[model samples]
Target: MLHLLTPDEIFPSLPEVDLERLQRRGVRGLVLDLDNTLVAYGGREAAEPVLVWLREARAAGMRLCILSNGRPRRVRLTAERLGLPWVESYTKPRRRGFRAAARLLGTRPHETAVLGDQIFTDVLGGHRAGFVTVLVNPVSRRELPHTRVVRAIERLVFALLLRRGRIDREAWRLRTS
Candidate 1:
């Protein structure tokens, strides 16, 4: 169970992710979380840097999809603004959404990477679905009530991992150049 929640990589932000490195590893697709992962919670649009990265990633021949648990309208609107496909109101920590995102990207699980801010939902779901997982710090501390509760648990888990030296806090905090 703990292993399922463990992310394969941790980064300070989405922009820090090395798309070229992922490509070298044969990751041809990306399944991204919408809210804190790409922008602040309740944000209706992607930030300029995110848009630039998305353009670059697409140009590099990577398929992308927004897989989010947000309301359908919000998700769809955001996706349209970013000019990307999306699966809204997706129930994470469940394999179905991850699988569906993979299908939408036209990539098998092994050839895809799931990037998000939540460990329990994004990491667990992606791991369970056999996709690589990248966990990024949330863009904002504000989140939904239920997500706040999960964040508490996530902190505890992160503390334990830190104590065991399984993760490097400073390394994960390094800002992208």
Candidate 2:
């Protein structure tokens, strides 16, 4: 399941990915989910650590762009503030948003990676779009009640994978990190 990343997943919290690794994976572009993945949903600006990561990723020569399901005003303001290329009203778990973002990035599906905090939206959409998918744990535990319910479902999905012996924590971290 896309919910689980490789064992190498690390923290603060980068999977320790950089340009060399991305190139090795044949990835030249990135599609990022805004909330929880890059910043907390309620945040107006990305955290300093996230900004540093973004800079590091860019310096490594990766073409990064943001794709979010948020409304036009929200997404646009965030993108403008961050100086990032972005699309608003992204309907994740569907191919349209991914496809549009890919086109805007001038990236082929084969050379793009889509990363987000939610498996149902981010991972599924990226996987369906034929890009490499990455699912990161959400940064915030405090969320709306609706979001909390989805988080529960997400955990259940991961737990099922663990019980099936498809994932072991250490192995998962190593692959992702």
- Highest TM-score: give the candidate number: 1
- What are the lDDT figures for the candidates, one per model? 0.86, 0.72
Mind sharing the TM-score for model 2? Answer: 0.85
TM-score of predicted structure 1: 0.92
Local accuracy of candidate 2 as per-residue lDDT tens digits, 1-177: 534322222223444445466678888888888887787877778878778888887887788888998777888888888789996645777899899889988999978888777767877788788888765666666666887898778677766666776667753453234
Q: Candidate 1: misplaced stretches above 4 Å?
A: 169-177
Model 2, residue 10: displacement in angstroms? 7.8
Residue 60, model 1, lDDT: 93
Please give the clash total of every predicted structure, in order: 0, 16
Top candidate, metric lDDT: 1
